[model samples]
Target: MVFKCPFTMDCAGSVTSSCLVAEPLRSTGGREMLRVHFTAEDLTRIRIRAHPHPLWEVLLSLHLLQTRRGAAIFGPWRRDVRAALHPSGDILTTLAPPKGYSPDFLTPFVDSPELDDGLEVVLSTSSATLRADMTRLAEQTKLPSWAWRIAGGDAEMMRRLADRIRQYHAQALLPYAHVFKSHIREDWARRAEMAMTHGLEHVLSTLHPSIRWRAPVLEVDYPVDQDLSLDGRGLVLVPSFFCWQTSMTFADPALRPVLVYPVDPVIGWASHASATPDARSLEALLGRTRATVLRVIAEKPYLNTKQLARATGTTPSGASQHAAVLRDAGLVNTQRRNNSVVHSLSKRGAMLLDKPALQDRAGYPDIRLSNPSAG
Candidate 1:
């Protein structure tokens, strides 16, 4: 059965199309592109999320980590979180598709923008939405026994699922709350600056190296033949710290469209080797200034020499020299972006932070990662 488009007024006579799927991309040169055909309304509605959406992040984490794509970017987070999650990790894995679709109801956008409020709203998902979402999910995957039980709208099942999400958040994400929020705020600031200074087109064009802003359509690289006709319903662009490699969109064409893209350099859970002696983390190991450079790179992950210099209050040459040292030590990784190079932390660098020898006293070894939808 075809579900009516949510934006019936704007997307007149629109119906969900089979072609609306976002196929996975081989992503050569970080170049998987999705050509999002945006209408004028979408342009007006184009805005950055003020805060991270809980459902999106939680659910996306499950999907990415399960697929092992998360290992590269989320090396530190994954290693640390896994030990804490235990049996909950197994339960969480069921809800998210390692590679395909998830039901829309599982990640309902809460009425409020706040994470707590949103999670509460998620807990209170309407029966109609749950049935619809679960039914859809059922169509795609051979869901486990637990999912079949929840499809009946059982209160006990629902409560258990919600509890798992709460537990998962506390275990996996809470520890990084401050750093994650800080990175998001920084991203929002940079986006706002770009929007104000460079115009919306630049904002789209520079969204990621893989994304290309061609007039009327935002092209994303992917492996299969797929297309998303936004019609007039504006899209929600959600930046995610855990979303790796590929940008994800909602599978159900009937729901409000969303694009969950990875936040650059958002993961650097590891410590870097500093020029300073025997210090555990990059900052302490490298001395204040050098560590600041690594931190800056982690916050922005994938910056050119000039951008790095400006952010770290160092000359481009100085940033270049420090980056080289970090790279030689296998702490930082660099990629070529045309004439310039982009720098970020290597998986090895993130692991350095995870080691007991370089452990931070305050960092929590709490919570295993879980997927709420799995239950």
Candidate 2:
């Protein structure tokens, strides 16, 4: 069964084609009925693969939708996806091609025949299931009815609610940035500096000055081993918390010192102090055994209880307890296949993990006062 919008064109430019494939729930008066079941992961995968850009995967994973409903569903999904894809630390620090590796390096990986086949299968299955669910939902609730069944205002409303929830969360975690200060040191500091510089320069070059000023400019300083000059000009070192790198830029004497800060203490202070409540919520969620279970499922959507338990360092019984929590939270759905139970993060869970932290003031400790040099 399918519910296709007549107004839209298919890939072949045919307007009559059904864009949505819905499974029939029942037949009433010789008419097939159908429910809506689109998963956030499905939409995100589609969005990521739709683009051929080398950074599409990373960027798509980081793009946070602002609708309230989207936030509620997708926030947890984003964290889980992040854990699944790059659990070591940050995605940019882990998956980023080594320095000097161009975007072309990813072409083969992205374009592999096997990869394409897998993607097609996944998308097709998810899309079909979604369509069927949407159809069923439409049939069940005829309110705000359409000529052809489709995801309606309810879906949009859910997304909006999710976004608001995430916004609140982000705001909440912005204060904990100081707690993680000790985590940054030496090489980590240098890498963070570089990442911050790269991101800052990118944003500055692309955005209007007025718009750019609206966003806080995070500055960092790294102790210099020797006097460094680029093109006979003093160099400023900037660290990126996101990219985990230190970047040096040539600038006037006044601006040079302004940009540089001791990387280790600075990053530790900034990250811990600036951590928003939402970030804390996410961290707390991810800290749970259930979140770990969902992460495993997201990584390999078909894991048995033993496999999941091994991956998460838990006993089968513990894993079951965690799974129960996730199931109750609506973060995952389980299926009994033969003798094994297969678990996967729900669409909502997948979507939740994709959003970035929301807008909040990043807290910075009085490093100047703490350090005797400023006096």
Candidate 3:
């Protein structure tokens, strides 16, 4: 289908009907859209976020895992994240709603960022602010037993809460947080280049499946049906690795407008899982047992946990445990099919399997045609 660039705005040159970003159309159903009306000032003020928000990603990831909405994509980190949250009790998990009111203080929009910076914002919130946030959250659903203590301005509890935030980040996010931000930068660079070359029209039209550029209005695919008028505040389009859904904005509509959208396929591919090593690399780096496991996976692609275990002479759980390590290193890629999850070599894994051959192929011959003196 052809997308027409709205003529009212200046795009210098026209855009082809083709999509510039690949993940948008695939990510959404295009059933319902957020019809966001833009004021003239909103146009100039509109921005694309250059990096992923550290706290937001953690909150979002925790939300998904608890609800199991996007659990398949998370891999073994599902278990690890829960363990990380254990120190905090059930309170941390309750803050990130799949939708509706979350305690704003806990997951505040980072007008300023950095995990500690945002946590400080949460911790430093006035008594009134904390009470208000807790009250709002309580109305939404049942909060945990200790919720009142934090809301009541218990300093010791708040200190412990901050530490919990640190622990949570370490477990769920530290492994891949920088990579997530880096991928966002990489994607934003492409969008920035496109906007520079083709103008903002191209940026909006192909922004995502859920978002559309229709002349004066910026359409977003939201859960509930409503129209949001930008009212000259403009929008911050934040690209996130952990934001698996269509897009979201700050709860406080009065706050500066922002839209948290998932990054494109490149970011998704980069952020989802890393590659696992092959037999040869394992032998050199780890041990012969690891090498043997790699060889078993290499011999057969898409081996389910049981098959992999049987082949490697280990239990299914053991095979999965090893595969998790390999997956993190950027060697193996795993997918779920029906009741089973299948694991196989990634491109990096393939290279690991045949690195010497690749090196030989890449080697260019320096042909020593007879040097006259030498001859």
- Quote each prediction's TM-score: 0.62, 0.25, 0.60
Give the per-residue lDDT of model 3 (tens digit) for 1-375. Answer: 111011111133221222212333332553544567777667777777665666767666765565444444554456545543434535566655544555556656665445666777777878987886677667757777677888887888886677666556644564444356557777777777776666767777777776888878877765434466888777777777776545666544555666777774342442343333322334568454455555556545677988676555466898898888888887778899899998887777667764221111112211111111222
TM-score of candidate 2 relative to the true fold: 0.25
Best by TM-score: 1
> For residues 284-356, could you state the per-residue lDDT of candidate 2 as single tens digits?
8655445446555554455678766755556789888888777778777788999999787676665665422
Candidate 2's error at 275, in angstroms?
9.7
TM-score winner, 2 or 3: 3
- Please list the Cα RMSD from the true structure of every candidate, rounded to 1 decimal place: 17.4, 24.1, 17.4
For candidate 1, the C-alpha RMSD (Å) to the true structure equals 17.4
Q: Is candidate 1 or candidate 3 better by TM-score?
A: 1
Ranking by lDDT: 1, 3, 2
Indicate the residue-level lDDT of 80 in model 1: 55
